[model samples]
Target chain A: METLERLLLGHPFFTDLDPAIGRILVGCARNLRFAPGEFLFRENEPANEFFLVREGNVALELHVPGRPPLVIGTLGAGEIVGASWLVPPYRWNFDARAVAATRAFGIDAACLRDKCEADHHLGYEMMKRLLPVMVGRMQAARQQLLDVYGHPGT
Target chain B: MNASVAPDPMLPQPWRVQAVRRETADVVSLDLVPLAGAPMPFKPGQFNMLYAFGIGEVPVSLSGDPADASRFVHTVRAVGAVSGAIAAATPGTVLGLRGPFGSAWPVAAAAGHDILIIAGGLGLAPLRPAIYHVLANSERFGRIAVLYGSRGPAELLFHDELARWRGRLDMEVEITVDHADPSWHGRVGVVPGLIDKVAFDPKNTVALVCGPEVMIRFTVAGLRAAGVADDHVHVSMERNMKCAVGLCGHCQFGPDFVCKDGAVLAYDRIAARLAAREI
Candidate 1:
């Protein structure tokens, strides 16, 4: 749809100057929704999809061996959700659950990856943009490990 | 480094806990009033050594409005033995308070410039008084943008106050939690991630950061990359403290003592020192 192409190109992350490239990206973008408490992806699953949040929050959680799942971070509107797909061993590192009824522009990572390889320029641009997201997530994870909030008990 | 002008910075005065309000699951804000003599008032970004009856003492920054000298405030997280004891104490309980010490945030010097306040976890408490000063004198400062982040939605402090600040036309308040549950409808991510969403004149901005040292490091880097000068940025540093005065050298950060020289200092002053955690 023309509107879909417009929306995809309008995203801050996807300010494609080339119309042909925009069309190719729009081809992989699908409008997807997740119900409250529904998972978009589970940990260790194939990381074949990435999302541009358009409506609600998604909690990215990791399961502990003897404890309940620990949510490492959450993603909301105007933010990109999955970065594991960009790296090899393309597997979801954490379970992403819909915090509320959520709407997003989901891009099938497998299809996108194939296209990016076919066009190295686009691949480089895409990687350049996604690098910050990956680094931000890593830094956030490191901060959590520091337990900056301090423990509740003495 | 702004040294204390107190008559005797070492003496502990009895300060009564007038009220205590729970800010989060693990933190509480205590409103304290001196039992007898009125010591020197606290400046924004300054801290007091709060001594729980027989427990011990820990430096806590004043979290109240600096303009209201009647009762000072300190938000305490139950991080260790002494801090936990203070957080658990009753309203009528009396504690030993000493030295409203440390360098103040550049609230006075930052006039006519945009203020970008970035905080994380319990760091917001130290910056809260500085925020109040700006809000109280709205015309003196340009834009006031505050970005705060927590471990999770349940860990966020000052929910109601955050809403009120966000409601103000003069202040721009945005908060993010590292993680969230279904009930949370706000932004999610680290504190630094929210930097791109707000608008401020980078060249004319005076940034104040209070967070985990790593968060502060990253934030300072990001702000500098975005055009803020090293000297224009300030950070409230946290180090272990024994004596509220400079005599015990327990809270030394590189060349300076945190209690006397600064708990708050310009980023450029100790940028290299902060990079080395053990120093």
Candidate 2:
């Protein structure tokens, strides 16, 4: 299978998507590569794309002045990298840098938004798929914030 | 044959640490054998009150294989003074062992049904015995899967065993970490996230979860969402324990005693209490 077809067809987020919709997605997707320590995006930068991680890790980092930067999360294979593109002000909220050399399918967000507007079926399908990933990641972040690792000190 | 081989439940029996292996920065697994006394029997999910000769005692779960009668095993995370003492003890260190009291995981009842095991951090220690039991009798179960998560990729316990278990075709093993370094290429999320990644027949499945109270509550909710019945889900709960017996009341959860009625409880039995902010 072609890389485009495989990525669009195999992503859990796109499983069972209408082939037309998949085709529309493939039309806007482009392959990407990043070397270690390369910045995919910086804090407050334009969030024009979201990556379907194909290989390697991307560190979502929080930089605190006068202190070492902290990695909030790591995005890896079979995971979706950016959700900020789906929301406005259409700006990145954190620094995403390649922790290792990475390969991904970068989907054009503005293009996807335009496509969604032109086709309600595609828009609804995209919403149903990506919203779950957003919700799931938020829940995981909340659980991590709680550090529910056993009764502390027990 | 009795509840425990200890002549008296209040008095502690002496056990010598045969070996201690550091599992992580703060956690250590101790291999213990009775010095001169008879070996005490324990069931999966049961806990022993281990006293650091001079510091104090705390209830730690039995993490060893249930069928291995020659020694007892416990993985301790050094959180408090007593636990720190126990974790730092040498091979010849002598510690006090009380009753292995508590209700057990439904390993027997879960036979012939698919087994879904979910654990977080040290939660894996308590459920390790049940995993061993299920794998040893794999023919009796329809399917078995283990999902584990931790604070970070570095905090994961039993890394080697997880790899070995994943090598088997019969048992499905998945792991995730809340925070991970760049080197980690596996799932980066909570344990519950991996639940949907594995396959199990909810109609004929038994779910066992062991983690913090918050994690257990979320895990049970996830299992329910995945078509598992409330009655079919079980969780190992934690509370401060002063006495292994129910008398001290430190391990009380509403009317149920965590030390006596459970550390392992059916989801239906405690769902309401678990839902309330204060219990």
The most accurate candidate by DockQ is 2
- Among residues 3 or more apart in sequence or in different chains, the pairs in candidate 2 whose N, CA or C atoms overlap within 3 Å are none
Worst 10 residues of 2 chain A by lDDT: A145-154
- RMSD from true fold, candidate 2: 3.4
The 10-residue segment of model 1 chain A with minimum total lDDT is A145-154
Judged by whole-model lDDT over C-alpha atoms, candidate 2 comes out at 0.86
lDDT of 2 by residue, A1-154 (tens): 2668777677666778888788888878888999988988898999999788888878887777886666777777677888889888999988988888999888899999999999999999989988888887788789888877644734
Docking class of 1: acceptable
Q: What is the interface RMSD of each candidate, in Å?
A: 3.3, 2.9
Candidate 2 local Cα displacement, residue A151, angstroms = 8.0
Docking class of 2: acceptable
